[model samples]
Target: MKSRRRWRWRWEHRGFALGLALYTLLLLLLVSYMLDYGARRGRALGDWAWEGQPPPAPPPGEAAAPPAPRHEAKRNESEDSDEAGPGSRAGGKRHIYLHATWRTGSSFLGELFNQHPDVFYLYEPMWHMWQALYPGDALSLQGALRDMVRSLFRCDFSVLRLYAAPPGPRDPLAPFLPGGGGGGGVNLSTASIFGWRTNKVICSAPLCPAAPRARSDVGLVDGAACERSCPPRALRDLEAECRKYPVMVIKDVRLLELGALLPLLRDPELDLRVVQLFRDPRAVHNSRLKAKQALLRESIQVLRSRHRAAEPRGLPRRHPLLPPGAAAALAGVHPRQQHRAEFFLGGALEVICQAWLRDLLFSRRAPAWLRARYTQLRYEDLVLEPRAQLRRLLRFADLPSPPALEDFVLNMTRGAAYSSERPFLISARDAREAIHAWRERLSREQVREVEAACWEPMRLLAYPLSGQEDGDRQEGGTVPLQMFV
Candidate 1:
């Protein structure tokens, strides 16, 4: 009887041991499967995140255009190769940044610098950043944009390679490229830049044999002629050309605030100066609406930044007011979705006004040294008094207003026709007409909306509110220029 009891106990112990071993094996298998699945997910996420280069889970209301082919190369081939650190400035160069927003007459403002024989100007060089990282919140991309501009100021063209991807089919510059492929260390040329055809440095001697060197007397270089004559010279060659100029002017509408640029301003080596441009909000809104389709992607991105900043951490990813198909509109595949486009456009304008107000407040309280380095210009003032304003603008930059430059300015502002269709194109236009075009173009309600949204900034900037008499307006008095003499 004792032997039988002991055997029973041993059998029970063996059964419990077998069960424990099976359970442990099953747990191990589950863990292995989970790890493999997680790794696959991480890689998939990496494609959109660019290995965490951009932020995650893009704002819900937006969709990025299909990302351009990724360029994976060694560290030497990247913009990281730039010698200057983020705070380090370039010496022996007077760097000027035209700080403005879209449709604020900034293109024309930039062209003035581009025409100067002594200035090497880059029109929206950071545009490549916005394009390559489409739908990335403007706030998140600010660092990368700032870095690119820093490198460009130092004449480091390798920064361009970081965004060197093949142009999309809808890209206007696509047809200009003779050949195209993008990969690690792809050989980029002048054709790869956004306004390359109009770039005087690329169109002139040593880079393109057919075109004469840029001079005030030369006026605007024939962009078409330059496109036909200039083949794709290496970007390194362009950088060599960039080094020859004393003044480097970069005009970009992407950088939204004056405060964000304090680091660059403080860089002793750069000797950096800023020219901030402002326009009447109503006029800006009108211009934006007219070019709604072309501006769709940018509008969505701006709105995304505004939404992200305003929303609480646990709130819904999308704003309640944002319409469905916002993503589709961004992708350019849903042209029929006009409502989505308009909502984004209006939201973007509101955000722009708020940003401008923030800039205005910051500029008012800046240190004396910073104030000395910054200047504010009004689009209306520029157009209303071209000769005087042009002289003032040049004086601020320490550039002389040559006879040829004066003529160029006059011709541009006094031209006969303004093409609404190709609004982005840089050409001559009736300045007075362009400034007041909003009065007739925008509906009364639209004007009211802008005035309400931008009332604080408008009041401070001396813009007249809707329904107010000219005599009653703040600007009725002689408004002093916030300029550094």
Candidate 2:
């Protein structure tokens, strides 16, 4: 009886041990599957997120265009230099950022700068990465990376906008879905705005994220506050960042406005160089009218509002409601064509965008970039004299104006072209008159309203005020040449 009992006990013990081992192995396998699944899921989402839409299909029998001529390397030169070499980091002294505003001949200027062998011309680095939440405010390092990672998981606009940073990019991607500047540097500079010398100084914010658990109840304030709350060390870090680079040129328009950018620019330590490019207000407005965008309404409204207020040459802006003021340079500058509400609103949009632009270029922002830290160039002048303007600009930026620039100009004009489109475009009159073009659809009252809306900005950019100037000149300003550089 005792032996039989012992045998039963042993059998039971063995069965229990075997069951426990099998269960452990099952758990391990499950965990492994989960880990693999998670990694693959993350990668799949990432691939989809970054993949751009495919090019439009060509019809049957239409061959793709022939390839352009490739540059043959000279035997003496290092091949790697022709492309961005592995040793390129050794040559990267400092970045030269060209902050190109929309419709402001940014590409033309970019190609021009790219002519110099040493200058690293970065085209809209920040603009390309925004998945859906593009056109957001400025940015920092950590926040930008988080947004990029989050963009992979979904294509939600509210979700996307939640992740945008206005200035540039931010970093960190361990866990994602984030929205997230101010400079840490402060230089007290007296700036004259509207003939009043206010002690217009900008203060900086340190670089740090807002508290992770902070609820997203309040929108802009939360963002601005979080930026404000950034640690002082980050501000110091940014200042130090510019120091390591020998010279950097930045040209993102999101940070261009005087009120928004002045504080960031007032850093005493930065020896920044800025180039302000001006487009004809009419052309700018015309482009704005034709632009198909999501967040553009706000910008268009801002433009239209400004145009209705002032004329070019410090003239009083026209307002259907406000009426024209005496000695207003912008008075009576209505286009002879019926105000195509959508198109002629260019008059309004140009007037408005240019007023602010004038302020940005010649006013407070101009002086800031123009300060020992900057240089200024006009796009009209550039189109008029690309070689001379570029050479002078190179000298101003402390870069050599290479003879190759002329050839570069030719190559860029004839060869390196990306899209066949005007840099700052004005819609042809017939198109402006079309039903979809906003001609047939717009009422005369609407035209007058838009014209009134455009009146101010027209005055500011010096659009022809039919009041004094003869309307003989074709389309307001100097006849523009090839704008895309």
Best model per lDDT: 1
For all predicted structures, in order, the TM-scores are 0.72, 0.41
Clash numbers, per candidate: 0, 47
Candidate 1 C-alpha lDDT tens digits along 1-485: 89999999999999999999999999999999999988764332221111112113335554354422112111113344344432333224578999999889999999988887767899987777787788887766766777788788887778887876554313343334344222223567777767777777788776787775533334776666776777778877777666556578999999866655665675666778999999888888989888898889888888888855432112222222212432232233222334777778888888888778767766676666667788899888887678888898887776767778778888888888654467777778887778777888886667666765676677678775654435553332224455654
Candidate 1 yields a Cα-based lDDT of: 0.69
lDDT of 2: 0.37
RMSD of each predicted structure? 12.9, 24.6
Stretches of candidate 2 exceeding 4 Å from the true structure: 1-100, 128-247, 289-370, 410-463, 466-476, 479-485
Task: Report model 1's TM-score to 2 decimal places.
Answer: 0.72
lDDT of candidates 1 onward, in order: 0.69, 0.37
Which residue pairs does candidate 1 place in steric collision? none
